[model samples]
Target: MSKTEKISELKTNKTRKVAFMFNDELWQLFKQTCETNKTKPTWEIEKWILNYLDKNNALD
Candidate 1:
């Protein structure tokens, strides 16, 4: 898909809420990293979780 389509999909699909506790300094760092990558922190965290699951063969 094109980048615009993907961005629209992300915007439309962010209808759910996920809550977690994040440390002050660490959360700031994560926010900066997400800004650097031009993505939301939630998306980055989702990618991290998916990668871990895939690497551990736990995606099934």
Candidate 2:
């Protein structure tokens, strides 16, 4: 398969939605962390949560 085909296959293989509640203070902290790390706040938070789950073997 072509690179695009492979990527598309991967994208279609799985999906999930994660929702949570956070106060303003927590959101500010997350935004600051993302800025300090030079990453988009939303993307960084999602990545962090995913990594945490993976490390804890909770992705099942």
Among these predicted structures, which one has the highest lDDT? 1
Candidates' RMSD to native:
5.8, 5.8
Question: In model 2, what is the error at residue 39, expressed in angstroms?
Answer: 0.7
Q: What is the lDDT of residue 5 in candidate 2?
A: 67
Q: Candidate 2 — which residues are off by over 4 angstroms?
A: 1-19, 56-60
> Global lDDT for candidate 2?
0.69
- lDDT of candidate 2 at residue 36, scale 0 to 100: 91
If scored against the real structure, what TM-score would every candidate get? 0.63, 0.46
The TM-score leader among the candidates is: 1
TM-score of predicted structure 1 = 0.63
Off by over 4 Å in 1: 1-16
Query: Tens-digit lDDT track for model 1 on 1-60?
Result: 654565456556767787899899999998998899899987777778667765786554
TM-score of 2: 0.46
